[model samples]
Target chain A: MNLIISTLRKDDLYNKKIIENIQKNISNVEIIYTEDMNIKGCIGCNRCWLVTPGICTIKDDYEKLLIKFLQSKQVVFITDLKLGFVSYKLKNIFDRILPLLTMNLRFKNGQMRHYFRYKKHYKMGLIYKGNGNREFLEKWLERVMINLDGTSIGTYNIENEEEILNALINC
Target chain B: MHLLIVSCTPRAKEKSNTDKILDELRKGYEYNGNTTETLYLYKRNEWESIREKFYENDNILFALPLYVECIPGIMAEFLETLKPKQNCNTKIGFLLQSGFAEASQLRCCESYLETLPSLLGCEYNGTLLKGNMFAVSFLGSKMGKQMVEPFYNMGKYYAQNNYFNKEVVNDFAKPEYFSKKEIFLSNVVSPLNKLFMKVFAKKLGCKGSLNDKPYQNYIKR
Candidate 1:
């Protein structure tokens, strides 16, 4: 299943439209709006690694999202821009996703990386808005996916429906 | 320079690698008669005050661990709250450290940070990139302190000059990426390293396998 997560608040008209448009155009995707959720950022506590084991210690709506991601083969993030990167809410989501990975390290394609806890590959794509660096976002997504033993589906702009289609098909 | 050092690690000051490095940095920075103050961005309730500090300070340095290949999410949240400084002559810099040993892991983030200060209407004070920072957690106390003690000299250099010294930064960024030969060597030693990590995790009270998945049912894709 493909998961399209919008990190923007649901009330922002432009953000809501962007998400609704994706829902209308795309097939077989589940959308998540994080702004209305009671999610907190990961505090770098290694409890998931040493204590809970694949379960984040923090109790929040993100636990459900992590389950969705574990079941998702393709995950595309929709982020409104902030400092040329994804919004804080989206970045917070990314940080909390760490529990799906093991604290143990292994070498893959020469560099060291954390082993995937669930042993599932997750191809990642990005849809970004505002005055952001699209190239940098793509590179960031590509690097992060590679670390998870997955390939990049690349990035797209809201208006670039053609690129988004290509990326989703490719993902 | 009356520097305002912002520690961006989500961990508390006592347990942080950022704290260890910054302590060494402060010792050297203050040695040269430069005064400094600190603020923790993890305290969300104080973000309003933190924003105030950002505006009031002449020189600001962000010391952070390379969490998930970039700045921590909370720090990203704080940075989003900041508006451009307009005419304020605040010079901003980054001190980025990571648990990963390779410098290549940090380059992508470094590239992003190069353009960050200019976007906020501030002068770039250059980034101090370091890796192999898992020591603070995995190593003994003395060994961990020894590993970060080099930041003292780096702090002294930054205090004397306005930006990071290229030599220390380059030394910290050794083996930016591995060559074919280095890869072959690293592959041979990979098993030993893995065993060491397992033992270290065990010592830190990891109850089960490091690869244990309590939520294995979530993988039914």
Candidate 2:
């Protein structure tokens, strides 16, 4: 299974265009419109680790999303660049998925990082909708890939819709 | 110079390690006879008023703990609310702390911090990244005082020169990457560390549930 999470505003022209394109070109993929979700930022409670262990204490849409994430073989993030990084909307989702990882630390690629709670390894892809510096985005994504214990197929700007479709289909 | 310190810790002011560092910086700023005002973002009720404070101040320092290898979502949301203006005179600096022992984990987020001042047309004063900060408070005041002395010096220098001292910043972000010796040591100690954590959790009455899957029902569907 494949998952596509898009943070495009509902009224933006690119929102409909990209959704239409993805629907036409991709199959068996679950696409999530982030702007329409009732998601909250991680409050840094540490409850996911201390209180509930592998579960987030806060009850929200993220609980359902995490299950989808773990079951999927690939996950793609589609977001606007805010201050040369992922939008806070998308980042809120990213930060809230701490339950997917265990607090146990390990070394990966010469850096200390949290170990994965689940056994599955998913391929990750990114699509950005704004004019952010590519170098910053690449570095950010590289760190994200490490945390997810996943491999990056690549990151594509929204202008490259055909390439994104190809990447998604191939994944 | 009037310094505006923004504490971005989600924890309450008294319990926050980031605030403890900010307090040290405040002491240094005050000793220099400079005025400092702080806005705590954890106090969500004041965020609207705090948003206005950014435009009023010229020297701004953002102190935050690294969350998931990046700035916390609240800080990102706060940044998103600021309107971009040309020729803005605000000079921005950042203090980033993390639980991880290696300073390299904070490097990726530092890139974002470097770009932030440019996005707002503010001059970049540089960022101070510190790791292994989670242990500072637990180590008690004697050790805590020693650890935060550099931040005090940083604040003192910034108050006098309008920029963080390059040497101090470099020292604060030392051992950017851990050595192979350190890695081997960490590997050897990891199991023991896990066991100790389990014991600690058990003391808190949460031992067996550390790996509880509360959402397992959802996955089964």
Candidate 3:
């Protein structure tokens, strides 16, 4: 199975551990680091959805990442929350999903609520590495899941490499 | 009149589609007798300190590239901190360049900016939505290069003869074509990515919330 991991920041310890574990268990998995992305802000032009349909009008590395996402069996986003909110890095990428919202899908609080309903269901994961309360994460994740049409198949908390490793192996 | 144009994108200098379109507009207006100054907002952290200049200008143009469905965080922050003095009289206008073919997102921004002039009691001139300025698939594509031509021509005519002419304003506010099919595709594809991100987070042993989960680097204030 092809695995793709996209992270906005590179210096987070929890993300590093997750990447290390993926490297150990999953071989030849392709990862895209959005922190390295060079993108112009969307010009509020609806060209991607209106003209090209399913394609972004801005020429940047987003297309490359989207291509990888379409072909991969699994996709991941690594982010640090700021006071119960996604990082600016994460938020920017999330916001770019505007084009995707126009498709035939149901979203809750700006996240995909139903994911598994698609013809193919891919494994999903999240690595939260912050001091915020865990309850905040759960509530937010539930909202995202509502839109995704899937549940968290596996989960691990801050600095829990062993539990995540076990979950990955079993899944 | 001394006019100020703020370009919000980080890459306003190189291979920047927004900058190219704004540049065309600026060139078109230069011959109209107004001294225009363009500033790249990302380059200066002290954007707030320049508020005084807005007071001095008669025409103010806010040119932006959309980030997600909203303005950039920095611009939002800037707007929050901007307090126009009582009786400030700068006429406000907007010019937006987007890679998309339709101008739907501009409405959201217009809704936000509409409050700007009202709050400050300034005249709301109008907004120009330039669509299909660049193709995200090939930013430097030939069609992308030609997209800014009309903006340049119109801006020149407006600047020289009619900066606030009714015909020019109407033309600038002209709506571009849009498609429901593309919108559907985007809506569908987006959820797929969000679902993948959630599963990926679970696999990594994330601790915080799924929708707005925290990364390790966000530990500090």
Candidate 4:
């Protein structure tokens, strides 16, 4: 099983501790870091849908990361709570996923829905490190999960590392 | 009288916060004796043609939803390409809508707020900060309808009286940089943002060009 962790915090001990715990629990996981990947803002261009079906036309890290998204068995995102929402860095990635906003998706329940279709179902997890609005974050997480046709096993606040780790490893 | 409204929502039919505010503004000011024309940027086929339209209009109002903590990328580009002609007498005003209920997003339009009057040589009217009022859950409810009046009044005040005079503008506090958390996010994410957005031209599909990549990356992250 492969896992990917992306976060907007670097060199912070608190965040580092959480990352280390995640790494320890899930061995052989490849991390695609935010600092190294350098994702850009989505310019609201629909080229991903009109020109290139099911793929983002932007040639930068999105293309590379899209491949990572395809290969990974589980996708985990860690975000700092800024005003009760994901940081703008994470928001940019979410915005760029605009290309994936198509309705041609195939759901596992033998029904078709409108979403960026991936070939299979993958487990999704969110680690919100800071104390932001849990309610809002949960709604957003649910929305994004539904779009990808993936199951959202759980969301954890970094303060409860032990509890969250237990949930993640078990799920 | 003709009023030109420039809307910056990416989806043409989608009801973004900006769109919702604009719709309300449009309805409130509809029978005030002017023919209003709306130019949705996402639907505009040509970039330069819109700039040409800007020069042609006398009263121009800009409406955009705040992204991250700033203006959308296309709005910045639109402002940059504007060449205010000698005959251009556009009276400019702004309406900003954002999900976060803070004045921080005002920074996104800092340059436009400062330069619109200087370049266009027109009066800078006041701006309405429609904060957290566009949620679908709030629509058609009395709370939603009543809250819109104050914002409309603010717009009417500015439209009727020039509000961005040097003294008036200066009275407001100078813009602040990102909070400590924002700084951490920007530093970590700006590099990848640059590589993913600029170098690869992944943003080519968008309407306008956001040339100030580095600064924008910092603000965005």
Docking class of 3: incorrect
Minimum summed lDDT over a 10-residue window in model 4 chain A is located at: A103-112
Clashes of each: 0, 0, 52, 7
Runs in model 3 with CA error above 4 Å?
A: A1-171, B46-49, B136-144, B160-175, B178-221
Q: Tens-digit lDDT track for model 3 on B1-221? A: 56687776645455567777776788778856767888776665657545656666667787776554435544543444556556766777777655444554355544545555665557776666655554432345566557676777767765654345545544564543334554567676876855664554455454433423112222221
Return whichever of 1 and 3 wins on lDDT: 1
lDDT of 1 by residue, A1-171 (tens): 778888766786666666676677778888887766788989988878766677788988988888888788788887888888888788888888788888777667778788788777777888877888888887888888877778788877776776677667665
Q: What is the C-alpha local distance difference test score of candidate 4?
A: 0.57
Candidate 2 residue lDDT tens string, A79-164: 89888888888888888878878767878878888877766676777889988887777777767877888788678898888988
Evaluate fnat for each of the predicted models and list the values in order.
0.72, 0.57, 0.03, 0.01
- lDDT per residue as tens, model 3, A63-92: 665445435555556666443334555545
Report the poorest 10 consecutive residues by lDDT, candidate 4 chain B.
B212-221
Candidate 3 lands at a TM-score of 0.47
Off by over 4 Å in 1: B165-168, B179-186
Q: What is residue B72's positional error in candidate 1, in angstroms?
A: 0.6
Is candidate 1 or 3 superior in DockQ? Answer: 1
TM-scores for all candidates: the values are 0.93, 0.93, 0.47, 0.49
Off by over 4 Å in 4: A101-116, B1-27, B30-221
lDDT against the true structure, per candidate, is 0.82, 0.80, 0.55, 0.57
lDDT per residue for candidate 2 within B1-221, as digits (tens), equals 78898998777876677888888888888886789899998888998888789888888999999987789888888888888756678899998998887778888888788888988878899888788777566457788767777778767877777776657766777777888998999999999988876676666567555666665554421
